[model samples]
Target: MRTDVLHAVRLARLDLTLIGRNTTVLVNVLLLPLLMAWFLTESVGDVEIAGVDGRLFVLTGMPGLIPGFAVFVNLVNSFTARREELVLKRLRGGQPSAAAVLGGSALGALALYLGQVALVAVWAGRSGGLVPANVPLLLLAAVLGVVLFCLLAAAFSGITPNAELAQVTVLPVLLVMLLGAPIAFPADTLPGVLGTVSHLLPATPLVEIMRTAFLGGDHVSGDGAALSMAGQWLTALPSFAVLLIWIAVAGVLARWLFRWEPRRG
Candidate 1:
């Protein structure tokens, strides 16, 4: 047990070092999200959406976007690259357990994701007057978002043929996770069928959970009636359940489909 933890930590450190050396990956994983949040916040200005400040609305969505890119997109590329290089195969034959190998590879990305979330939270609090109405719920959403996206990344990596193909394969899931959520508009504002589909997207629950945590139930409930923080948490249960279901599905897919070696023609 202790050995697994140590191995995972060592692997995480190595991954972090590799990320630091790669300027493009570092920028995309760490800097791009901050810039996006800044630009989106600026564009929205002080307008209100669903009775919540637009800047706050955009800021709250960072939990969804950061993890989507840093964990899901980045991990698909990482896993695919390693598989193609035979690194995954070698590791599978070595001392590190599968859990340690996968968890360690994901830890570095998770760390970066968390750091970006903190930076956004601090910026939002100081500049956008975004105060958390429920800190526990906020933390829960962030953790679940990271775990769910990590599993999704692992599952998707199995389908990606190479690092280059990861870029193309990640787009559909990325678009759905980002645009399908209430990032640019309120959840209730999405049109008919689009609204129903958006609610089912993986990132939607995470965004909804964050928005509810930072704003309140009325902001997400769309009824114009304010809900107690407890009520807001209650309303978020469905979103939480959605995340759990995705996690389970992704876990099963990843276990079944993940390849340690590159595919042969």
Candidate 2:
């Protein structure tokens, strides 16, 4: 047990070092999302939405966006690169279980994503008066976002033939996840059936959870109703269920589709 943990930790450290050395990955996974958040926050400056500051609303969406790029898009490329290089195959041949191997490879990305989230949270708190109403719920949403996106990345990588193809493959998922969620605007304003369907997207629940945690209300119930902290926690239950379901679905797909070696030409 201890050996497995140690192996996973070592793999995570190595992956983090590699991520630091890769300029493109660092830029895409770390810099781009933060910049996007900053830009959006500034654009929405001092505006109010459903009684919550617009900047806070934008900041709450970072958990959704950060993991999408940091873990999902980045790991798809990471897994593809490692597979083509036979790194994944070599690791699989060793004592670490498949879960440990994949989890360790993904841990670094999760750490980076969390760091970006922290930066956004601190910035929002200081500048936008975004004090989270339910800190635990906020953390839960972030954790769930990381796990689901990591699994989705692993599953998606199975269909990605090469590192170059990863850039193209990630776009559709990003579009669906980001656009389908309440990022740039509130989900309740998305119009009729589209609004209803948006709630089903994997990113939606995570963002909803964060909004409830930070704003004490959600885009769905947009009448400026400030939920008590306990009420906010209760409101997050449905989103929690949605995230858990997606996590299970992603886990199944990853187990069935993830490839340790590159496909034969």
Candidate 3:
């Protein structure tokens, strides 16, 4: 058990080093999200949904965006690049267990994930009026979202033919979560059917969790009408269950589909 932890840590360090040296990956993982957040802030400026200011809404949903770009995109690209370079294939012949290898590979992104969370939290607190009403639930949602997205990233990487094509394949999922879900837009503003479908997305529940945490159920119409769709669904546990289901599904798919060797052209 101790050996496994050590191996995973060592591999995680190596992965972090590689990420530091790779400017493109580093920027995409760290900078892109910040840019997106900034853009959202600029564009949405002061528009309120229900009663929540647009910037605060953006801050609340930033956690969901972090995982997609930081964990999903980074890991999919990392795993596919390693496979193409035969790094994962070579590691298999060595002493490290698969769990350690994969876990280690994910450690860097996890760090970035946490960093993004902290960044959002601090920024929201000072700049956007975020005060968590349920810290435990907020943390749970953030942590689970990171883990779920990382697993999904690995699963997607398994089927990705090469690193170059990863960008194309990854965009759809990212777009759906970022644009189609509540991450980029307020859930109440979406059409009923669109909002319902968006709620089914992985990022939606996490965003809902954060929204509830920050707004403390205050983001409603001043006259006590027009509550957010997320606020309405906050009473249900289905969102958490859906996230768990997706994690399990991703794990199974990754186990079955993840390749140690590169696919033939």
Q: Provide the overall lDDT of each model, using Cα atoms, as 2-decimal numbers.
A: 0.81, 0.82, 0.76
| Candidate 1 lDDT over residue span 33-92, tens digit each | 788888888899889877667788788877777787888877888999999999999988
User: What TM-score goes with each of the models?
Assistant: 0.93, 0.94, 0.88
Off by over 4 Å in 3: 218-236
Per-residue accuracy of model 3 over 137-189 as CA lDDT, tens digit each:
66777778877887888889988999999999899998888777676465656
Look at candidate 3 and tell me the lDDT of residue 94. Answer: 89
**Sorted on lDDT, highest at the top, how do the candidates line up?**
2, 1, 3
lDDT, model 1, position 94: 93
For TM-score, the strongest prediction is 2
Model 1 error, position 182 (Å): 0.8
- By descending TM-score, how would the candidates be arranged? 2, 1, 3
Q: Which lDDT tens digits does candidate 2 get at residues 124-194?
A: 78986777678888877887888899899999999999998999989998888767888767677879999
Segments of candidate 1 deviating more than 4 angstroms: 216-219, 223-229
